[model samples]
Target: MTQDKTNFTSQQDRLPPQSIEAEEVILGGIMLDPSAMSRISDRLSADAFYINAHKDIYQAALRLYSQGLPTDLLCITNWLSDNGLLFRIGGRNKLASLVDRTVSAVNIDVLADLVMEKYQRRQLILAGTEIVQLGYATETDLPVILDEAEQKVYSIASEHSASDLVHISHALADTFTEIEARHTGKGSPAASSGFYDLDNILGGGFRKGRLYVLAARPSVGKSALAGNLALNVAKTGKMPICVFSLEMSTDEYVQRFLSSESGIENNFLETGNVSDSQWQPLSVAIAQLSEQQIFINDESCPSLNEIRSQVRRISSHYGGVGLVIIDYLQLMALDTDSRVNMAQRVGEISRGLKRLAKDLDVPVLALSQLNREVEHRNDKRPVLSDLKDSGAVEQDSDVVIMLYREEMYNPDTPDRGIAELVVRKQRNGPTGTVKLLFDHQFTRFKNLSRGRSF
Candidate 1:
């Protein structure tokens, strides 16, 4: 036992993965040719250096470059001295030695990549150590522990890998290729919302890596709209759809889908009171829905981490996910302590969903509830400010769509049975109101015909 403990200690004492020579080369090359900083600035940070002194030297050079000044040895020494970090970084002699050893900045890019690789390895090791510590935290819940562990590992893999800047010429070439592909009917950069007017207003459809928020007062059909969108995406059969139903059960959602697809009354389906005539449409609806790839999780008030983990799993299993829909955002849980208030928790949840959309490279349609302030107004139309709990929902979303039903507010109004999808905010397109015919019996919304009357 004593010998094993000694070996373990020795292993732990070994230096973390790093390339000192690469760090020296990068610092030296930057000082030798100040222009080299542009090539490697995005790829490497000062923390990439293994030694503290090397980190300080690189940081000083970064400051000089950012200020539109030369990053020569003398400037670096003066900057370090001015910052009172000269002796901490081994004095002026250290900067002189780095410049003296390097001849050119021709290989600075390669050295920068090598340094980043070492830093990433060290980060992985540290993540593993933290994960081990989490494993020993018996007081924490298992799911929370697992989620934290995954987040730590994921950050090291993704957040640390900075992308190089692409020149406009190269970017234009790729854009042209995409445009040609679209023209040839080979592919599209967006997925259709399955509604003609909505698609037009969305500049095509829901784009990948975007967060779309659908908010409304109670009984205005935001969940129904989300369900409709999900069913449409699933029907495309191009990619799988994942739905997290925090407020509804999987059975209830499926029943709603059946009623919507069959044009039958939702109450009839819920009560299992289908007539002989309705059985045929119900069967056909079931068959059609079964052919599509849709997965649902009905865990009530699931934490954001749980949703993220499940989405990742489904995405991995299905090759890719076309869309992810959360039944409602306000009901989702955030695993936070007592220090976090409700508003802060909701803000974090909103931001986490946005990040999840970007990380998974899929569109996330999150249903939100409008605040009661909308009801107090004479217009009763929700704006971006009506998003409940926190303003972060509007801030984090790339698009915000609010639902309004005149019939709900004014039963005798001429627009009865018509629903208005108010495009309150669109990041890349014009915002306007889209009218759709709503069938409360079937719990569905469809495009309004020009000549049709309620």
Candidate 2:
């Protein structure tokens, strides 16, 4: 039994280290090859240089043979280099000869000790770490591992449900901080800069993270009204914002901003009707805006991922993004050219925007096209159903706001120029309407009459 134990140890020692065993030390204690580890490490996407256990010429040859390379010294060095572990060439054949020469003289215990020592030496040389310490060694005793805050963020994820439940826990708790006065919860409580009665009815302004869709017939100031609200937020420094203009250029959009800031009509800017004295206000507004963090990304159409990436970049570089405005949702790109209905594609886009808002913890304001059913109705005012393409928009949004100017459809009416800000759905608050004053001169809208007095 004693002789059998000796022979068993000797045989195990002579059999050579398994590629899986070597990799066990390289990565975690589990078995894996370098290629497998590399893939598991996401292609080693960042620049990182680390060393591993040193192998003898015979062991190197075994590795080379397993990897389908020539069993020669040069080939061994080249293989290591190609696979990202590198060593000098001259030592290989000498070590191989030593392995064959010293095999009988070497005891199993001595060889194991040598292998362990060499691993420590290599790790010490490559990484300036104390191998004996609990958390600093690489080659032996578990690669020194540490956790990062950002990685912890990605490592955690929950099993998503097969279907969504709309029962948002309305338990406001204390997560709701009063961003404005007179509001005790998370929903928008500031009257939109439209009409006072409308503000009182709608219970304030647009809610955070809610997708506000505005649709209109051919040319009923869609851009104008959207621009007006966006500029109001910018001018007031209300919150960090973004404007995705699918239909206009940055230059044209700037023209609209200039009109709003100067209280000058677009017609004046286009036809030179503005007096020279008015240039001062435009200049001041321009200078002030240059210092503010309001952003405008005017791509004709952007994919949801592309937008997410852009938002990530903006947030990282610009100290976080707040409000996001998409000119229209129907223009968003569908994931693929499968013959899916427009409504499904719109739903996907709407869902994506909502997720993005929650993920980034910001509000998303999107413009939408109203179905012609709105036009056919006697009221001509848009309702939740009039939202183009997707009823999902109403379902997913915390608030759904639609714009309808009575004058847009009727040439001569008492409400001629009166724009109604209808809150079609308030996921967490009262649903109602607000009226806004549409000033053609500035091409902007404001509360009919209110705070800081327009």
Candidate 3:
């Protein structure tokens, strides 16, 4: 009797954790009511089934439902036969068994949850085993192993959080409500960069879950523009803006903010040579900025993974990080063991930044330096192609703004001190240029005054 019990326990352990009865119920419900498939699609997938026959049948049902065809018992059987999977899936007899076992279609969602739960448990077992193996390995760095283990678990969690589709009518109703609120000035809309003309051209403001790229040649004021936007967003006090400066120090960033806020020359502030008239504005600027919520990190080099982790930490403190600004894109790092080209690494970094924005549900304003090729051109206007290192930078970006100043090329031109905010690529709106006055002394960008033509 003891030997018999041991044999039974061994057989049970050999079988992967799964609920075959629940899978059958889910498949049968879909056959009984085609609409049941739509309700459970987001919660379960074919791989969730432990039995081969059940997996094949569920796949067929999905194909039929997706093709706008019925998923009734006969249709699924015929689909399996036509696809040459019927015999492999235990033929018609097994299909009939599923229909007989299912009592009702009302609890399809509940059955799907059961199947998903079993599948996740199996996944956890596998992931835990891998972690154990990694713990035993002595060659790999402990930190790297830990990172990989965390990523494995995160992937499972992320997969379970699949998005559900909303009906068009419901989506439209929500949009209409938002519009009404905006019309009445009742809603606090997405944060803007505080430049009215630029915001107006952008259809309101920098929306959540968007990646905006600002590229310019050296000294054209991309970093300054990023700082200006950061300061403006923080001034609202609705949410904090986190700026990661790879090139500039935190002190330099703060000084730029002070000069921009006080309309005082950075040179005067840097040397503590402020005039009597400038001291009052400086003090006021200090007081105003000290009241706002602005976070800055001037880490010289950080990988994409590190940046994501840091952003998540900062976001956990308050409502969340409303906006993320990276001083430049090319400065960010990526991990790769294989021999990849520079452009490919840059592409990976760009795509990672876009994913980070969407995952955090916030706008990421990343600065980039334009290629030197722009200088050889006659116009010297930076274009989308000039985004250094990778073409994916353009492909992944929702909006691309380039900075142009003819004064840099020709000091005698009347456009001196005027920076052109060129909307080179806008996915959801028109592309045009909005001029802003660039005061290099204060390291600030301001909306051009009305009736003052550039």
Q: Each candidate's TM vs. the true structure? A: 0.70, 0.58, 0.69
Per-residue alpha-carbon lDDT of model 1 for 1-454, expressed as tens digits?
0011111232476766778877888888988899999998777888778788888888888888889999988899889999999988778788888888888899998888888888788778777777888999999989899988988876776765446678999999998997787677676677777776887688667888999999999988888888888998777637899999989999989988999999999999878888999999999999999988889999887788888888887776787788999988878834454488877877888899999998878899999888899889999989888889899888899999999999898999999989998999998889999888898888888888442110
- In candidate 2, the residue pairs with backbone N, CA or C atoms under 3 Å apart (3 or more residues apart, or in different chains) clash, namely 189-204, 190-204, 190-205, 191-204, 193-447, 194-447, 194-448, 195-435, 198-434, 209-363
lDDT of 2: 0.57
Rank all candidate structures by their lDDT, best first, as comma-separated numbers.
1, 3, 2
In each prediction, how many residue pairs overlap at the backbone (N, C-alpha, C within less than 3 A)? 0, 10, 0
lDDT of 2 at 211: 58
Candidate with top lDDT is 1
Q: Which regions of candidate 2 are displaced past 4 Å?
A: 1-208, 272-274, 334-338, 451-454
Segments of candidate 3 deviating more than 4 angstroms: 1-161, 275-283, 333-339, 450-454
Candidate 1, run of 10 with poorest lDDT: 1-10
* Cα-based lDDT at residue 10, candidate 2: 27
Q: Which is superior by lDDT, 1 or 3?
A: 1
For candidate 1, report its TM-score.
0.70
State model 3's lDDT.
0.83
* TM-score ranking, high to low: 1, 3, 2
